[model samples]
Target: MILKIFSNNYIINITKSLPRGVYRILPSEEFKKDDIVVFEIPEETKKYLFDRKYVPSIVTSMMKKVASEKIDDVIEINNNNELIINSKNWGKVYKYDSYGRKLPEIDVKKMKVQKGEIFLLSDYSDRSFDGRYFGVVPISSIKYKVELFFRF
Candidate 1:
């Protein structure tokens, strides 16, 4: 499924915000928070949602900075190899395996932002399939940030 957009990269000067409608991906790397981005909707979400292959979303949360190796809080590594985050924030700590690796089940808070993931939200949440259900999206997946919308 391909997202259609103008092939030429150009910017238009306009004042009023365009009405809510379908937008094509105008791939760029200068997107900021709250910007509406277009990405290939994950296959998992497509099973029960929109029929389109690509979708638009608003960036609700953006990673401030890349995480470094620092222990801000302790976190437990569950049996599934998934990090269980009980609190809102995930601290900076590195996870590794030692000789005869033992999966530590410790209580801690905070989890670092891995892969610089961004949280997305749908413009029309009530009827839209978006980040609320898709979870955080990596910056690499964002194809474009919508600047204008059009309807036919």
Candidate 2:
């Protein structure tokens, strides 16, 4: 995340953040709109994972896009349980994993992000674990922002 040694190299991203591609990975903490950001798994999310989830081979970090960072941006879970942010539909809320298994629950009907946190979404992959499942994440969790250098 904050490692300079990981820079200046073509990092092939197979995660859900963006279409699988070769990207210029940067060690950064700044939040830029539409930027592909990387963050360590949220501590609040540990409750739902296995006991050894922190092991490097397991799920260490994840990459996702900020669905909406604008102040007072409204996030809503519709009657159908779809996630709509800032009046735009993001998709069905995180109810199932990529494998179709049922999962951790969220009960928010409407919310306005005043500060301290931001919502994230899978850039391309459906069922990608993100804010839709774990809910709004603190801004402090962001560790890096990546840029697409090439796409396959």
Tens digits of per-residue lDDT, candidate 1, 1-152, equal 12343553422312112234345445667555456655544555554333332223422221111112123322344554433333322222223322333222223223333455554443222222233234445667655566545552
Clashing pairs in 2: none
Expressed as tens digits, the lDDT of each residue in 1-152 for candidate 2 is 12223444545676544777776777776675567776777766754654423233465567788787767677777888778776777777666665566777765554445477777787476566677777777788876677777777
Q: How many backbone clashes does candidate 1 have?
A: 7
Q: lDDT of all the models against the reference? A: 0.38, 0.67
Candidate 1: misplaced stretches above 4 Å? 1-19, 22-27, 50-113, 123-125, 149-152
Residue 145 lDDT in candidate 1: 65
**Count of clashes, each model:** 7, 0
